[model samples]
Target: MARLVARRGRWFIILPPLLFLFVFFLIPFAFALKISFGEAALRIPPFTDLFGRGADGHLHWQASLANYRYLLTDDVYVVAVLYSLRTAFFATLMCLMVGYPMAYAMARATKSTQNILMMVIILPFWTSFLLRVYALESIIRDNGLLNAVLLQLGLIDHPLRMMHTTFAIYLGIVYSYLPFMVLPLYATLEKLDRTLLEAASDLGGRPWRAFFDVTLPLSMPGVIAGSMLVFIPAIGEYVIPALLGGPDNLMIGRVLWDEFFGNHDWPVASAVAIAFLVLLAGPIAIHQYYQVRQVEY
Candidate 1:
């Protein structure tokens, strides 16, 4: 009776989150999936229904795979998707490279110092994300603080073209997402067994060698977690790219927006979004697989 009661109690604790996921994520996904198979129509919802009563006085199912088919055939879709992927991959790489060292330093710091550094890392989150990106504009834009300072210092005769460039997009992604990478890495590094490193040192292993062989391998889970955290959202990022990037820097998010609002092609937009979600799931699945393996080991 106690065991059964405990089981029910556990489920009671879990039920709200399960219900939330079902209501929010799953339900919306179902709607999008249904719409992906729809055709754009001159109606209220602007898309054809999956089920309707026909003129023959019978209920009929209607669906079209034309949107998905068009996705494969469209050069714009392919180019946008490829660009988004490339941008996300490089941005994730940059975040990881910069964050790993910062996280390592934080982990190595004394407890009070660690607290200060952690606060510094987290302070940006207190401000609005969009506002932070806008703030970056003040530093990077022409006649902004950075260019002003550089001019004052005689570093360059002219204000460099910083805004509305691919470099700005990359900078935006890295700046915004760096904390996400650092936090996970710091968590993993903090909980690491220092005794193992000491053991390796006692065996006359070099610091760099120990880091490569022991620390890096042990920290793989955190690396993967932080990577996914940055990569997934960065790929689907609309606001930053739309604001910072030029016309040439077309991402999938922009493509989706133009398809939905610019072209008013609801079915194709739904298909693109669904396809994007499916693409994102691959990384998520890989992360879960590694997490399970880590737990098993």
Candidate 2:
């Protein structure tokens, strides 16, 4: 009777959220998938075509693979994909570099210190992301605070060209996503046993060896989780690049936006979005498999 009651209580708690997700998230995703497979041109009718032409001259309902072919063969799309991948990869790397050590330090700190550190890390999130990026622009632009400081200190004769460049984009991404990486890493690190390090030391392992064998192995899940959190959003980000990136710095997200809004080609935009999903699905599947294996082991 107690077990039955417990199960019923759990079901009550789970059902509401599940229903909400089914209504909002899953339904939208399904609709988007259907629309992507159809002729979803933004014409006068403003309707979707599944398999037949309407009054308009456009192919209303034709199923075609030309969109996918274009995505695969188009040099511009390929370059954009490569650019996005490279940017996300390096941004994730930079986040890991900046976040891991901070997480470690926070994990080892006193309770009060840890609380303060966590607040400091999270406080930036209270402000709007766009505002923060704009603030970054002010700091990095010519005649910005950085240039003013350098000039005041006689470090340089002229202000540096830091805005509207790859460096600015990288810096913006790393700054924005650093807290995501640090928080997860800190959670894992906080749970780690200090005695494990002592045990390794007692067994003749050097500090580096102890870290490699004990700390790093145990922290792989956190590292992977943090990397994914940082990388995935960075890959699809449109605003930061639009604000900070140069004309030559083309990302896939920008291309997709241009197709949909600028050129009014919903079919091509949907195809590009689906193509991104296809490219990212492999990595995501592998990551999920690894996550499941981690749970199993």
Candidate 3:
């Protein structure tokens, strides 16, 4: 009786979040799936019904794989998917490159300095995210602060075309997502045992060699965690590309937005979203597989 009560109590604890996910995520996903299988319509809901009443009052069901078929056959969507993946991968690499150093510095700092550094890193979150992106836009624009300062310093006779380019998009992504990368790395590095480095040094290993031999391997979890944090959201980023990038930047997020709002093709938009979700699942599944293998080993 006591065991039964305990199990029931555990289930009660789990029930709220389960219900929340069902209500928010699962239900919306089901709707999207339904829409993905639907055809574009001229009417109110903007998609043809999957099920309808026939003239004879019998129930009729209709579903098409046309949208998925179109995705496979269309080159534009394929290109967009590739572009999004490429952009996200590069952005994640940039974030890692920049954040790893910052996190290492923070981890090496004294306790009070570490707290101050962490606060500085997190201070951006207090302001509006949109406002920050807009601020970046202002700084990177042709006649903006960056060019103005460069011109004032006599570094260049003409303003560089820094804005509305892939470089700007990358910069925005790295800036926005740098904190995600830093925090995870900091968490991992802070708990790292300093004695390992000392032991490596005792064996006559240089600082760089010791880092590669001891520190890097131990911090793999943080590297993976931070990469995922930056990569996943960067893959679906719409705003930065839209605002900071040019017409040449045909990312999947922008394509999805244009399909839904620009073309008013909800069915196609849903199909794009579904396909993107499938693409995202590959990385997550690989991560899970590796995690399970590590646990077993």
| Alpha carbon lDDT at 289, candidate 1 | 83
Measured against the true structure, the TM-scores of the candidates, in listed sequence, are 0.92, 0.87, 0.93
TM-score: the better of candidates 1 and 2: 1
Q: What C-alpha lDDT, on a 0 to 100 scale, does residue 100 get in candidate 3? A: 95
Q: Which residue pairs in model 2 clash with each other?
A: 51-61, 52-61
Q: Model 2 over residues 1-297: C-alpha lDDT tens digits?
A: 999999889988999999999999878766655556656455763335675666785665556676777777879899999999999999999999999999989999999999999999999988789999888988998888999999999999988898888898899999888889999899899999999999999999999999899998898778988899889889988988988888878888899989888877677777788778878886688678877897898
Q: What does candidate 2 score on TM?
A: 0.87
Index of the highest-TM-score prediction: 3
Candidate 1: global Cα-lDDT? 0.93
Q: Pick the candidate with the highest lDDT.
A: 1
The digit string of per-residue lDDT tens for model 3 on 167-281 reads 9999999999899999989989999999999999999999999999899999988899889888988999999999999998989999999998899999999999988998899
lDDT of each: 0.93, 0.86, 0.92
Regions more than 4 Å wrong, model 1: 1-12, 289-297
RMSD of each: 2.2, 3.5, 2.5
Give the residue spans of candidate 3 off by over 4 A. 1-7, 286-297
What tens-digit string does per-residue lDDT give for candidate 1 at 61-94? 9998999999999899989999999999999999
